[model samples]
Target chain A: MHQAIAILDSGVGGLTVAKEVMRQLPQEEIVYFGDTGRAPYGPRAPDEVLKFTEQIVEYLLQFQPKMIVIACNTATAIALKHVRSQVNIPVVGVIQPGSRAAIKATKTGMIGVIGTENTVTSGAYPRALQELNPDTSVVSLACPALVPLVEKRLYRSDMARTVVSQSLQPLLNSPIDCLILGCTHYPFLAQMIAETVGPRVSIISSADETAREISTLLHHRGQLETSGKVPVHRFFCSGDPETFQAIALEWLGEQIKVSPVFWQMTRLSR
Target chain B: MHQAIAILDSGVGGLTVAKEVMRQLPQEEIVYFGDTGRAPYGPRAPDEVLKFTEQIVEYLLQFQPKMIVIACNTATAIALKHVRSQVNIPVVGVIQPGSRAAIKATKTGMIGVIGTENTVTSGAYPRALQELNPDTSVVSLACPALVPLVEKRLYRSDMARTVVSQSLQPLLNSPIDCLILGCTHYPFLAQMIAETVGPRVSIISSADETAREISTLLHHRGQLETSGKVPVHRFFCSGDPETFQAIALEWLGEQIKVSPVFWQMTRLSR
Candidate 1:
């Protein structure tokens, strides 16, 4: 499709997913929105997370995107089905793709999931994994401390490792051969997590699988972009542009301009 | 560059590298040659490996490639420097890229390497890792049995896990935070390896890093192909095309035509 693929997260965490999309589908343009102002939607109620997601999706509709990717686990957990019903185009959420990847990776049917409190409490991953294979045994942990560590840029610190170590003890005690990084923010702490968990567990991220799914869906629909033109990606954040740009550059491995996006309730009325 | 990037391996194992190159650089044409007739260069003499790598390099030169990648770890260990001196084009090898990735992934400064006998014996990974960081400790294992399993298409059986478990016992006993799948074929057995080693150890494969290095080199040299057309990849094997093509299709995730390449002794006379 000539139209861009729109993706949004609560904050810069979704850049992990965006980075994979760019690497796997270089020809397709991306319109990304990060609601950093009201980020860490992890602590919010489902109704508020859904409302925020709707606002961003509404804002993203101006790009005339062919697909929408709910890149944040919390947003995907609470808002995915609601947004899918509201949108005319394909709307993909992170949980299903992550669950599918874990299913494919695990030799044992036991899987561990760690995400924000909202995502874990909602039981999204366990439901998704069990639905895919009823025999799958899932251990879910709510890592409420991680998102703040990542957002504060303290992921590499000793304190972060201590937090990760303490949080993963229950799952580590289990027989999980695969662990899903349920939050988009969690991948930033992958090294620490892997170190704490040891060598036996395969860490599964939704970014690569989500990108592959998008490519497959686009190809099946004959909407795969075939033009030779270089794709220009646009980034927007409802918070400090400089902060967003810095994190985006660090995570995506490229320097790109970030523009500020303010929500206008009147725009939705139109 | 308009010309293709040439890659050669002792056998079908290098298809892993070829697969990554295709995924990451879709617009760049590839000329791949698999020296399957004299396959399993792992146990061969260093001088013999050098001679064979030179012959393949000479053969690939006829394609007018802009860069050459020594996709086999054994060939890289024995002949990379010699091959680089002989060719004017940039030559990339698997060992350095894989070592760099391992160094980046390891948290304990303890790394493990699993490869063919020649690769492990060459002490290439230890040298590379130590050169990058002197404090880094490396545990090298020669998993000579694994390549045969992959080549024989027996990688998915229970026997494969048994083989992997037996092979990785020493590394599992160590404090390694990362394990390098030094041979390209090793990635095919990654699931089993991960299960044997457990979840704490990160698996590092050179394919993705090698592709990135190729991209960086091409970009730096102003040789990156910016054409929007789908690049066609050519495959040649010095042995049975049917066997190589089946493995290539399975490993590369695409249907491709494999051409038989006979070693003409008289061609070297020119």
Candidate 2:
């Protein structure tokens, strides 16, 4: 049996990454764990987010994935290093790929980033961008209200436009030519974001870049699936399975059955 | 053993479709045959194109594919129904999906289509658009020169820009809000095409839509790969393996090994 790629996130936001992984590396089986029960890790403390991420990674380890993808921006900002140290297999995060894309996409060396408050405050994007190109100018904003709208499935609603417009007003004033949808959930609001920023600004989503990185890594490691077989993707949500399934189907453009993953604080040791 | 999705085209043009299928359904093994030796089916007689398509289909049938995708526009325009009649498995074409995407994308109902001389002359897109939405006004241009440029790997060259500018000059004059890269190879010149048409026109490529259609068909038929394994993709070319391999790697974003598929005129009867 080929080892699967394990991906974990705070909630359904990670589904964006999973969708891209499915698109770019369709042959690799995926074992996805979305900690939807205690989701919206955006507002949570770093220690709490790190703890939850570790717990989910430990849970996913049972399937013996060859690599791990931290699909959530908040969790990645807080827990990527900790998770990497804890896991024996390769672990990837959304930040580096996203930052790299912004750095490459920006013609003016002026880039803007939008994410949850925690991720923005963490300054991951700015740090990554500056490290990549020292002369780059990074402007980041925290759209704290956007995730809840997404969770409530109001991404296509008029209210989403208003929210996106108001949130992006500051960034629009900046001279940035590229806007990074720093949070995975922000991709759902991409249309409104695009409309608000107009065509001049390129919206960079980490999903595609992240998927490419995973593919390149798998190939170089000789872990890419080369057999003639279709991969079975497994989804586990610590929250409502039905809700997760619906969103997964919508985002993936296919019918998918999602299973519930029950966890408790006491089960952390196991 | 899992069955592969069989895709055939006149030449490397189908690599665009193959690339999308890999991105959208990465887990499913693909058996791709490019009839490159006798390619540029665009200018060939319909009967000759049909006969070549049938022979490729017959050769691919040996792989026991679960479905067939006619990735070439000329083949799709002329031989889709014939191919479907010959094969028992699910068969998909690029024209309908591309037409549907154009319909969905166009706000002004004024659409532009660019393809080889055969596809444009066949009136496939115009007919498809009219059949779906009579209100749609379709403008098509026969880009007879573009394919050879692609075959010779001049897609990103200054010559490509000049060629694209010349071909698109008529369409740009029209009120077309959306332009369809009707030929599979046209996607290679997408940047040049987009530059010629400017940012107002949405460039529609059938690759993603075709991949989605295949996914939907496979899922509905309960044929989606649910196994936790990696799929190995096979490539066959009735032309130069080295040339095909170079293009495949560049287009697919991975290093792929290509095998030669020799054909004889006498074997048509068998």
Candidate 3:
């Protein structure tokens, strides 16, 4: 009778958060939705991202989850507050968690953020970090190429290293001690980014940090699952099921079954 | 007029949390109480520890703080749930934060905890970790000598190194990736401990973790300080003011002041 934690993302990127939740909280159940069909939400308009996010959350709500997690930085930057206002359960976003972890890890107030175009344009990481501490200084860059690499399930390909290196060229000279992986998709390329940035800059992944936030919030509310039984997690994707399953299996390192879902497509292309 | 976050502890050990909160959320005002007169709650009975914690919380409540943090491991182990039941505001403890951090940092499910005698005897760290994920394996050691070194503000002395090494001798063979500084006081000697354990074991300071928890809870509730003004923090200790001031100034790396408070000295001689 345990209520699952509902997680929604733009695509397979959130499998990072989902994997962490499963590892850190083995007893808890999860219901996940990945909107892969319309992903690279990175380049989409805010209104459209927000609308898509609302639709995904509405679909997941039927699971009667105890908590809702917006596991995509693009969606979170645009829709976290809106989703929070709409839900009775607690709504968690990827931005603030990464911001908090970076604040903790950074000795210098200079923090770096690399996210999707939407998250960068929204100035969400800067806003989140500065909101907690006004003295914090942030530098942001949008790494638009990284998300599609993950969506296509090719993060391990040598081409990912090239795209990551190119996208992160501008941040190489920044004096930040800690870099926030502001896009959930960026974690798929973490090794390449880490090698590029070297050990001096600690990397803060929003995908991992969001899992901690969920654990903390659920524990405080006395909503943590303690059934001591293996939980059956369900995952859905509004796109090609085989592609989503392939990416999920690779990212999560488990043979998980994914259900295909359909959604209405709108045509205001950028 | 900003409402303060009230923090209570057995002694200056709580300053670890205070320092983190100051560094992480500079805009939030803090009101701190340290029961230095009853300094070593770690060796005291659970009932006595709980009573002392209640008295400190009672004194701190006069500020009408927005939140309460039980920053001492001993007091938190014995009094956290009781205090939560009595207060309306969110009550945070150091144990869970350290536990969560250790869980996240561990590649092996094996975790290590070093705390006060009471914290170890109470089995709070094991409970906190296993409660979240039953697969977690924890090894606990009660470093009773460590608190006195920090309390006396002698953590930098040559004798402190010998004492820390002797105390950590038992854990030398454990296969843990991350070690939890279960006692708040332990962070004062973090450098020496790190040197002793070598680089393989990652050290976690519960003091720093608790600050993250406070930030997360406040943000979720939309109660984060947005005044954008430099906050004035207040600290009180029930022991000799000079000793506490020396420790506070040294640990916090600032020329700040501490107020001396007196409590009814209970005759329950341990």
Task: Compute each candidate's TM-score over C-alphas.
Answer: 0.53, 0.55, 0.97
Fraction of native contacts, model 2: 0.00
Runs of candidate 1 with Cα error greater than 4 angstroms are A1-270, B265-270
In the predicted model 2, the residue pairs found to clash are A23-B23, A26-B26, A26-B27, A27-B26, A27-B27, A227-B232, A232-B227
Candidate 1, residues B1-270: lDDT per residue as tens digits?
489999999888788888777655656799999887777888988988898899989989999999999999999999988998898888988887777667545668889999999999999989877754566789999999998888777888889999999988877778889899999888889889998999999988876657655654564356867665677899988877888888877888789998887644335324
Q: Any runs in candidate 3 off by more than 4 Å, and if so which? A: A263-270, B263-270
Candidate 2: segments with Cα more than 4 A from true spot = A1-270, B264-270
lDDT of 1 at A199: 94
- Assess the local accuracy of residue A170 in candidate 1 as a C-alpha lDDT between 0 and 100: 80
**lDDT on C-alpha atoms for all candidate structures:** 0.83, 0.82, 0.90
Error of 2 at B120 (Å): 1.1
Best by TM-score: 3
lDDT of 3 by residue, B213-246 (tens): 9999999888999898888899887788899888
Ranking by lDDT: 3, 1, 2
What shift in Å separates residue B137 of candidate 3 from its native position after superposition?
A: 0.9
Best by DockQ: 3
**Predicted candidate 2 versus true structure: per-residue lDDT over A39-137, tens digit per residue:** 798999898888888888888889988999999999999998888788788888899777765755567889889999999999988976665455678
Candidate 3 global TM-score: 0.97
